[model samples]
Target: MASPPVILLLVSLLFCIATQRLYAEQAPNYTFVKEASEVSPLQGRFDYIIVGGGTAGCPLAATLSSRYRVLVLERGGVPYGNSNITRLENFPRTIADDRPDSPAQRFVSTDGVISSRARVLGGSSCLNAGFYSRASPEYVAHLGWNGTLVNESYPWVEAVVANVPIVQQWQSGVRNGLLEVGILPYNGQTFDHIVGTKVGGSIFDAEGNRHTAADLLEYANPDNITVLLHANVHRVLFRTRGRNQPLAYGVAYTDNTGSTHRAYLERNTRQSEIILCAGALGTPQLMMLSGIGPAEHLRSFNISVLVDNPGVGAGMADNPMNAIFVPSPTPVETDLIQVVGITPFGSFIEAASGLSGYAGATSNSDDFEPYLGIMSPQIGQLATYPPGERTQERIAEAVAQLKVAVAANNPAALGGGFILEKVFGPLSNGNLRLLTTNVSDNPAVTFNYFADPADLQACVQGIQTIEQVINSGSFTDFRYPQTSTAFLLNLTSSLPINYIPKHTNDSTSLEQFCRDTVTTIWHYHGGSQVGRVVSPTYHVLGVDALRIIDGSTWNFSPGTNPQATVMMLGRYMGVEILREREQS
Candidate 1:
């Protein structure tokens, strides 16, 4: 009925709409300098060189690139299109992958605590559980940071990667359980730190796609920033002028092809700086390698001490966790740390449901039996005995039963596991020391978990609190009826021998249990404490043109998950660096 011209216009509009939809659905094509050869004849100078293009490094580089030539050297590959890094459902598999170059780099501490650190461009933010929360106001003030500036800076990173979590059924149950146990009136969905049950922000979006810190680079001035992946910085290169303190002028790094490359600061500008955002483990390790650790420790390795900052790799702390795995008879939708219970006792009890089960194992040889046993403190005690001894008998029995359950594809046994993690705040002590002069070798990491009696007591109390939540009326229907692995085939089984808490109310048994089962929540901090290794302004003490702006500089771990604090610190540092540059 329309005129010929009108008909043509209608067809054109349809074509445009379809084209736009197609474009919107298409994945982003990221251009990365993955090979050393790609940066042929690497530039001799950059205004700022950020080591470790990680959670902090990415945002810092993005901010600095607005006015300066910034270089970000990441030891790992890019996360673009990597399923393990982008998909929420792939959480466990990603961290469990043992490949040296995988996004997750698994390492065991000297105390037998097993964990992993991120190796990808986004670092641990890309591999972590994706929970996000702001640092407690008290914690922010403790650092003597400009509280006003910090509050202003949080939104810059939050706008890019943070999201209000989508609460599913399991998370809802957790919320109700916490309230029933008197965690207090619900704080609801919020990003601020409060003492109550609340749903905080997550890096994973509503569709279950993960948005990592690397995504913040979209705000960067690409023309001024060059991000090079697989660029492993071995040490900071320093220049000493007329007996002045050693000034960081450049860095020596290895590329993807194992070729050594050097990138230096422009001699013309005193504003040029080498910033270490390489995280708690990497930053201190790099400093020590550059002759900036305890004088005696460096001397023992025959490495010249650059600064003799004894605090460079001291006073490390990690949030130790004790978890309870609850299985379900029905399939539950996958979820993560959506609802958190902040207790008045300085402990955090969080519950997550719907992780993939044993049936999803990538290999037949994959042994999940160790994971089940490892989550308990009893396993650590069993390790002291020889393989066939009585101490090992209970575990062996539990493992056999678990294997049988897995083989039978029991809905109650195969899938639908919920984890209740009790993350304690700032009370434990640990340290990282160089094992070898070689940068590739992992440092000797020792988390003397629960070494302090107070920490042990807190963990024991935390476990008791978690049990209270689990036993609450809200979780009655969702709770797994089976308790004994030995008779798991029996539909009405009580508590599995493996699932039993070593001692329900006995402090000694609980303390022993904590020793065996406690592992890091991965909230590591203070390897280079503020005012110890670095000034409160975040510059390294007794050094020139060097700053640390990552978890390493935190005086103590925040009272909650530290990703939000890490990002906030990155933004705060970026602003400080900018201010300093303007003054210079």
Candidate 2:
């Protein structure tokens, strides 16, 4: 019944798949590439299809393929010979670096508020600092989740992949040390002896060098899991007996060459389930395209609503940490080092979690506070306004003041003495929306930070505290303006407010002077929550045989690198799925 042209196209595509399979076996760890000049239709199917094989997807694919036939669909090509991924030593910030940008950068634009995650096979982890921490037990307990910690979730993750630790001991930089001085006031005891007082533990003593799930994927058995590079998942193909409900059958996608088609397994092949580990942004975007989100929003976008789950794209939460930069008296060679966190007894109660205490115990040091990198979670609220609203503008204004304070303190940013204290969020309660019915089109991401005065207030206090430490301790040996004086001067000066830095007096401005200079460290969460977006079983509320397991499924942001948590989730989900399939 097929037309001559269609039959010819199918024949050509089949030949390409056979050829690639042959090459894949020969170079198991390398990219099996067809030149950009080769045109071929993407037509293939597997029992389980995972889109975006990054942090969560890679682990899930490796785990699930242990038994069932699994196919991972990735938008970016494999980095076979790319120096960025291969060079384990250079873990610098991926922004503007030659490394392939992650999907998280997709949402970001010239304006700071809207940002996107990475879109490669290894996802954002491909571009991240390789910081690893198991999600604290508190985050799961608060959400009534049973398994989300290092012991429960991490061990399995570690078994399949490596959680590389710091190879050697390193000391905190001047900025972090100075910031620690400010929190000392909250503790009456000597800062050194107080458990959970000073942040440490960035030290890793030559434990197995940590590697990513991508590394495992290449080294794992090739016969079971087939990674189709340069393949983009366009949509989930659904079939319904009538109009009552739709059953997910297969997927439709386009290869690098631009030919598109629908694919399904042979006549009798059956899959017990399909797991969606496409990550926070991609998972929800795929769901929206598949008609599995808020009915009203779907209708607005002309996307047919498959399951009317109002919480599908709601409850987006992120950490808004303020960075405290301190000038060092002398420059020293250093890699990544841990800066301790000090929290008052009342502060822990205020944050509504006991993680401060737990983290202190696990690290075997009295400084039982959190350690922050760009990925560390700091508590602040900026949600006093809605996304793209007035509150965000106010935050931008506050950030501008903060930038001027730094410029005044350090005339040359290129010097090692200059530290950038970045405050991440006064989190905005934003949601992910489908920009178009097509899954490939980027979705709209708006984190409406600075919506609440409380969010700004918390950060304001953090800066004030950090400033006090620098002015009082051995830090006083250096020249810098007191936050109080700087803030007071800003109050007196009738300065025009803007998001750009300007000249300001170092001695006269108050702490409030440097407020609006904070920006997001790219920590995103909650758009696709556990109880809200998916059921406790990790399945789409009304859709059978489909579940979401990734960072987006997080109930609350844990205030740190989500890589460990996301990887753990994939491992747990894969085991659960396989177990259930075996029982059935």
Model 2 TM-score relative to the real fold? 0.69
Candidate 1, position 11, lDDT: 97
lDDT of 2 by residue, 365-469 (tens): 443222222221111122223223433245445434333433455421111221223233334467778777766666776555545565565556655554554
Per-residue error for 327 in candidate 2, Å, reads 4.1
Separately for all candidates shown, the number of backbone clashes (residues 3 or more apart, or on different chains) is 8, 59
The segments of candidate 1 whose C-alpha lies over 4 angstroms from its true place after superposition are 1-34, 355-414, 481-508
Alpha-carbon TM-score of each model against the true structure? 0.84, 0.69
Q: What is the lDDT of candidate 2?
A: 0.51
Candidate 1: 10-residue stretch with minimal lDDT:
489-498
Q: Report lDDT per candidate.
A: 0.73, 0.51
Against the hidden true structure, what lDDT does model 1 obtain? 0.73
lDDT tens digits, residues 1-584, model 1?
99999999999878865644443243344453445547856756899999988889988888888899888889888776676567666565566555557776656666665666778877888877788889888888888888998898789889988999888777787789889989987999988889988998899887567788888888788778888888889999987777578899999998878888888888898888999988888899999999999999999999898888888888887777766566655555667787788887777878666534332353134544422222221222212322224233554565455556656775555444444455555666778999998776789887677777777787777777766766788876666664432222122112222222333322245456565556666777778888789888878888898999898887567756888778777778888888988886
